[model samples]
Target: MIVMNRFARRAAYFLIIATTMGAVLCTRVLTSVHAQATAPTTDKAVAIMDPTLISRGEYLAKLGDCAGCHTAPKQGAPFAGGLAMGSPFGTIYSTNITPDRQTGIGHYSYAEFERALRDGVAPGGKRLYPAMPYASFTKISDADMLALYAYFMHGVLPVSNRPPETMLPFPFSQRWGLFFWDTAFVRHERFKQDDKRDAQWNRGAYLVQSLGHCGACHTPRGAGFEERGYDESSRLYLTGGANDNWFAPNLTGDLGSGLGRLSPHDIAAFLKSGHGAAVHIVTFGSMVQVVEDSAQYFTDDDLNAIAHYLKSLPAREPSGAYNPQSQKAQEMAVSLKTGDVEHPGAGLYLAFCAKCHQTDGRGVLQKFPALAGNPTVLALDTTSLLRLVIEGGASPQTLNGPPTRKMPAFANQFTDAEIASVLTFVRTSWGNEARPVAKRDVAVLRGKLKK
Candidate 1:
């Protein structure tokens, strides 16, 4: 009976493998047929190389923030990719995009380049991981695509540096499976202008949806790891997404955690300088890199357009509304000032955070971010807040921004319960009605960070 059972289990495992291989083969055939049917009849000829075209391409590259992911931290050459991008499956290192025939994309023809960028399919039919953000790049206009090609092929210096190839384990290692994923999720369509909106609005939409690929980070993902929405037509677009231990806050015009309180100018200023004087909020997490590598160099008009589009998004998760006049807020303020340590974490706040954040929960303008009514403070997910407290953070040093400020990590100074208590107090007080943080939440995050 034991021998029979062992044989049965082996048979079942083989059957499962056979089924998966059959499915993959079937999908590969379908994908091949689809490609043949939809392949372009003629390649769009590469634009004539000129200084004007190269300059324009350079500007577009900045808009895409290509270097932010392609270049490794501290020592990487521009676009000689070796950045380690974290994902659910495993670590995916970026490929070298420099124009080196041996190690980079130097051999790619214009058509091949377009296919890789727009369809996530490289030369000789190699399928790229969605980490490349091709879903958003697919919406890039033909003219702009040619400009980018010109810039990459001619303007950028070639480097023979080859980054390590991505090798996800098991079923994930099967690249053909991505064909079905793309067929089901990716929209192979270009941006269509909204006739009802003005040119500026349409331009903003194009930049945000296409080259900027903002949705790649801001929009939430589905079970299959596809972005929930691509455009403003869907409420999920820019409603917040958590990735790699950080939460990218909602960009919609929600009264609480989104940008409803901020104007277009404020948004533009924040993008350019990492701090908006009008709102007293500074950039944190991955957004600091975005400002440093991409947004800070944007032309005034384009910055305003991107800001305009973001502000136009309708509110989705509008729960945390600030009311300074509320009894709870006034009580907390008075308690802190009068040395009343009644609140769960008020005493700790006075000891560590009060100097920077102030007793009233309003931080120093342009230096420390105000906790009251701040979007990060009111965000539903407390992951970023927890991480910030445990492992400190610093303001980005932009060319025109004020001097950078650093927050000391409290992981060594405070226990998990203490950190949770202080964060919970900040969220609940100062008209910020966000949810409370638990000790376990901090403990779980701390353990992950250690790993």
Candidate 2:
């Protein structure tokens, strides 16, 4: 009996070991695959310095949005690097991008930076994660590339904040796996001018398709993070994208349904200030950072060129903006409760909003947009619109066309239910016709608040 027991115990120990080994193997395999799926191709990051070269690098850095991603929040140093970005996969830490000899890019040569920016390859040929967006930067002109190199080498102060590693699932931790992902998805291409188009259009194309990485946010992603469409070839290009849980609106020429309301100058103005009367609506969510940081810094001519280029793109029909006059909506309109004047939503609106947006639901002219007729009230997905209603409002994107004052958040005064009711009432009232919002959505958004 003792001999038999000893054999059984040994068998059980071996089983545990096998299980653990299998798990480790699976993790490694999966991580490699995940990394490859999103790793940037052709890493070329290097450390080198020349006075003239550094000046050129500065321009490239601005166009590339280097500081926005690499700079730590509220730090006196510029490119010290420690920004934390949240993605569907996990949190990605921006590395030390400064000229610090011991801890930053000081060790890298010009070729290394170029490779990192264009090829997505790090030193020793390790792959960079796709968050760097070198896939887009590869389209930059050689002159612009020199400018960018100059900027990083001299203009920016370097700190010693090495960004943290990403916290992806086990299978995604392997750096080598990023190779496969790049192989399948990444394509190294140069921006070729259309023989028929003018200089402005070509410049806009390069900006949109390359340095700006506009598609990173505006274009939808296919399986494995391959952009659904890289250029105008795909109908899905720049029509919209899902970003940080918010849907970026379509930029196509769908005048009423998409960016049709924006004129070229208006688009330029909006990109400059985040508000304009052409659209007269403000956006929240991740785009707030884009305008506040990168887009606002663009030159007038560049902004105008972008607007003209976008205006020239074809408008595809987006199915989201359903007509509200269907039989179902008409019935719901009749179903609204009439005797709720003293209800929480109505009370809040009367107490706080009546001065500017009258009790009848009409707001002042260009000074204040009428919520009754606003398309924002009529969007099928009310997430952004609801946010605006409860958060007070955002400043108009236009600098000159409209007033720039923004609505403030009201998290302190009204409860979630009250906020929902006010938003629902606006959707159903004064000729607007979108779905009503729920209190739970408000509660969920509330959970995302910093305080």
Candidate 3:
């Protein structure tokens, strides 16, 4: 009887332990769910900072192109954030980055802000979509991060406006799914200086991979639509990809489509001046904004460093031949002259373009880019070409001084069909074999400009 009583006591003890374990597990699950639903709450007062810190922060912000994405082209407010970015998943609107207490990031502590920038997680454990470019931001040094926080918190004016909530399709809408992606791809570490490389190279690498986040546009996306990687090890890095409506050209040393023909000095000159002195190229489309907002502000040393890093990148073969001197090109050029007297494209080119580009399509050196054998002109994607035709662009002032060369906006003068016809002529002529620009494409871009 005594032995049976002892056994019963032991059984009771086991039951109590099991019950305690289950309750603890339930509490943990409930807490996690609650945290996921709520954003971080803060009542801390804004810290007063010195001008030096604020100025540094402002520079960092520009370096990252914060305003380019956060501000709509012609909408609400800067950093109050209502820009709708299109992705394979769906449209994602940028969040208000202003320091407003309720609708913006005014409540974010330095730790919280760092978490969002580096780990792609928000205050409430909510995962940010890859569109935030946290993968690149993750490489930002702690000093820079602190400066950025100071700028946003103390420097800029806060607005109470909250951006529209982003709604993705079914499985994608589940923000929790990003946890796996972050774990698999995003590097949470800070930028490290490579001892083997010179100071300039390392600085360039950090800026390109982290602050500048060049890979965001220049790197090709994988099947999951994430950038392949931000470093030289990845095959897709800097081989070029589309940025919204424009195709960022290959930045590697590829002979045909990339910067193989240009020297490091030429690159630095282009970055500093927004036009190549020796290489025949001009900044337009997104590149124009990059120059105006970011690259133009970089120090001469930093610009050279960036150029050096880009020059050092191993070459990747361009997909297609960029042969303007080939027999096919000569035939196309002949066809342009002979095909149709009433062909709006041919006539337009002869009347509008021949003066600058010359009758043979070989533009004057350093004045106008030649249509033949130019990477921008021969690019498979015709967004820049179309942009140049309809909107017009100008070369930025260089160390040499103010720019006199400018392309006048044709949007006011030409109909969409006329623009398309002229662009189609340019694309087909002089051995350029890119697909013709469509009137619909021109119309869509024009409509956006009006808005």
Candidate 4:
């Protein structure tokens, strides 16, 4: 009877232990969920910052392209958050970053701000997807970081807005799921100068390798979706790769589709102005968006260093060149543009594009960008030109800003072959050698039109 009683006592003990463990687990999870659901900060400190500091912060903020992420697309107040950024798992919407006391960063302490930038961790410890690019911001100098905070706090207008819900797949979306990713991926710190490099090189490195975060888009990500080791440490530094069906060209100084020959001045000019004539290329696709908000406002010195630094970067062969010389591709290029009739494509271009973009293949400055030596036409990333053709053209929005006559979209007026012919004629007409795009290419792109 006594032995039976002892056995019962032991059973009760085990039950109590199990109950305790389960409660602790439940508490931990609940706390995490609660924290993620509520990210609250006030704007008092931000409101108190000096105007000069805020101005400096404003400049740095522009450099960071804060509007690119924080701003809502088309409908909402700027930086009030409604932009839907797609990730492999699902869509992650940007959060409100305005100075709003109730809905934004008005109350975040400097430390909290720094942690978020460097570690991709939200104030209450939510993991931001790499889409936020805290990985690159991790390397930003503290000075710049402070200035950015200041600008957002005082220089900019505030909107009482919160981002829409961020959606992710089941367990993957859980805030707890982020714990593993955070532990594995995040390293909160700024860049330390590489003593081996010169001051100019180091400064340039800091900007591109860190604040510019060029690699988030330019450098390829790994299977886990983190940057392929976020710095120049890996040879894949600026090497190109395909992401989400979009191709990122190699930025290493390789001559073919790379910026090998651009002088520092050229690089600076291109970054500041968005037109690089010598390379016969212009920023397009997402890059044009970058110029509209960020690079154009950079100081000339920073621009030069970036240019000098990028030009100095050695060229890399990311993949075998899609040789136009190949038997199949070469034949394909020839068949697409027989130039059979004095066609409407070339005819229309002769009537329209040639006047501003002359038959001599040069463009009228401030009126039309040069097509002859224009870099966008020659780029391996013809996505820009194609997007321009389909969606119409865009002029640079810079210090001088665009003169306001936006390129009109001609989605309905031209056939795929006609569009291809006009582009081919321009590319080949003025020593600009590129593969002639087939009607099939245009037809393929036509299917993606939103309108």
Candidate 5:
């Protein structure tokens, strides 16, 4: 009787949600039809595809990192899609953006492209998932949108690659449900210039908030999975967020886990080469892809602007601090030289880590990233660190950057408890003051990685 009652309750709950979503969807359809019918048609002249426009579009595409998502690794042609993006609901495969009539956006008009990029509504009323980052793309200016369209239509090579269909389960599978999601969460506004701010800052803001979509990864999400804040207007903007098991650390002016320690030039250099010489920090995880595919190609002026904008953001929810002359750091250095394995993970650090990351936790410049004050090491969330240690990672290969340096995995070398202890030691020692990593935390992550 209890099991039956529980099943009945579950059914009723689903019914309520389904009924609400259906009603909302129907209302949206009617409203959309009416809006389209009533909307005045304008016969705007299409601009001639000049070299300059096409070149700008190509640059914009890189800035947007369109290839990052659309180009499936070792599988699909550039922008031919088939990339499987894992979401909370299920796997959402990227659609082919190449100019292939049957399989891509070849049939899409500028209007259709605009709607899809800005409003998340594709042709035939097909709703794109938020995984597309249209919310941020919506801020792109009219001129920039035109350039992007021109590039996609004329500059890019067409491929008739039909990527796998993304069929998420039940409620999430219902594309119409996103109508309400858009209405409530998406801010349908173009990039607005701040009269008070300089052109450089505004340009940086436009690129970061719109084409760059840095906030898509850096900004925290709300209950509906909407970005908590779009720009610097809200305190939560760029304070850090996790995506695909890696934590994109805070980009605000927080001394420990943010860009606070680095100068504007350092930030620009980091974007260009994936190495911040000022702080001895290097890109890891998904950021390596960004640097390789997008940021490395950015013009010097634009990189500086981005760096300036990031530098301007005030600190929020600050945690962790680094001091090179701390007593703990001194003691650790002494212990390492004296063969004292007194500290919990000191012996392991000497045996495994000290060779690359020096006894003092400072790494080789432009080769291995320093562990002492590295933002990834001091981040509140230990997911990235844990994964990096267990699974290993490589530095991005860039036009000007050093040859890619690989970190070896220790999954088989150490036990979960040992991993946790080493991480905890690293986090706390060498003037890095962050929380400890528990054995359970390491075990949970390891188990997840296995599957």
Candidate 6:
């Protein structure tokens, strides 16, 4: 009996070892296949050094906002890729896209580059994190992709700077898991024009959904961290989302919290100039980067089409709107004129914000953005407000016009509590009924900006 028991125990131990080994082997095989599957089997002379193609590539790259993320602040080389982007899991560093033979993408063939853009697959079947926005880039046209490849390979000056490696924790660190994520969430498809829509609408849809990758920041994410909606059919599409401590306000035609009041021309003008000519609206926070880098470069027709498409989104009405004649407005007016000796926020607002924004909270037309009736001010998310207050910014400079003015960065000037108070005061006053800003929120953004 003792001998039999010993043999059984030994058998059980061997079984456990076999199972573990099988798991490891399976993971390795799957990961290998995932990486290799997207790699081109044959080398082809796919790209030619044509100036026109290179110029087109440059335009496409601008549309893709490549430099905004790929170039680190104060970095010497563009696309040398040392920018540190914060994600829910961890900090992910952008990779070098410059065509340097050693550290950059000089070694990447056209096929590899295309695969990386469209499939999120790096060379050797390595899966890139979704932060790369390949989910949206997958919809770019084959022709555009070709041009982009030529630009990166031949037009761009190669840089050898290697960014810091990304280090994620535990399961996230294992890139094999990203394979399943891709299969479930990513659509490896090209843009298809809808026959029912006009050419202009289709063009708008393509730009918004694909090359522009607007949903990357604007759309809310599902439980799996994928965008809740990629197409306009879904209600969650372009309804707004908070990313990296800034809230991208709703692009939908929601009356109170979205762009319902803005006309198609107004929207187009905003895109072209980063501020509406008629409305007292200006780009602030993270959107400043988007406008400066991408939107300002859009062609006139494309801008109009984008505006038309966005304005066509169904309007969402707020349950209630704040009254302009509220007690809060009266209090703010008193504070602005005489300075609220009791409230620190009022004093700060009057001192720092009253000049450009005006004492009445109606900013100078086409110069300063109005605080009153502003969608961003009244949105449920206060991140944008806090971000703007902490990191003062300017509107995008267009070919025809620059920003009327720039707001100085107040990060060092105000304490977290002070910033929170001022933002809260702004939101509460001037008929805006959004929630009060918290010190914690200001602190978080301040910390991130410092980093």
In model 5, which range of ten residues has the least summed lDDT? 36-45
Worst 10 residues of 2 by lDDT: 39-48
- Candidate number with greatest TM-score: 5
lDDT of 5 at 380: 89
- Model 5 misplacement above 4 A: 1-48
TM-scores of the models, in the given order? 0.91, 0.74, 0.75, 0.74, 0.92, 0.83
- Residue 135's lDDT in candidate 6: 90
Clashing pairs in 5: none
Q: Deviation in angstroms for 295 in model 4?
A: 2.3
Model 6 CA deviation exceeding 4 Å by range: 1-47, 316-345, 397-399, 409-418, 438-451
**Model 6, TM vs. native:** 0.83
Model 4 C-alpha lDDT per residue in residues 412-436, reported as the tens digit of each score? 7777878787777655544456667
Q: lDDT: which candidate is best?
A: 5
**Candidate numbers, best lDDT first, in rank order:** 5, 1, 6, 3, 4, 2
List, residue by residue over 201-269, the lDDT tens digit for candidate 6.
Answer: 998999899988999998987756789878798888888887887888889888777888788888888
lDDT of 1 by residue, 53-80 (tens): 7889898999999999989898799999
What is candidate 2's CA lDDT for residue 15? 45
**144-163 per-residue lDDT for model 5 (tens digits):** 98888889988999999988
Give the least accurate 10-residue stretch of model 6, judged by summed lDDT.
39-48
The order of the candidates by TM-score, greatest first, is 5, 1, 6, 3, 2, 4
Q: What is the lDDT of residue 220 in candidate 3?
A: 79
Q: List the residue pairs that clash in candidate 3.
A: none
Model 5: lDDT of residue 120: 91
lDDT of 2 by residue, 197-309 (tens): 88898888888889888888777776455577777878888877665556666777764346665678767766777655454445456665567657777777788788888
Q: Per model, how many backbone clashes are there?
A: 0, 48, 0, 11, 0, 1
If both were scored by TM-score, which would come out higher, candidate 1 or candidate 4? 1
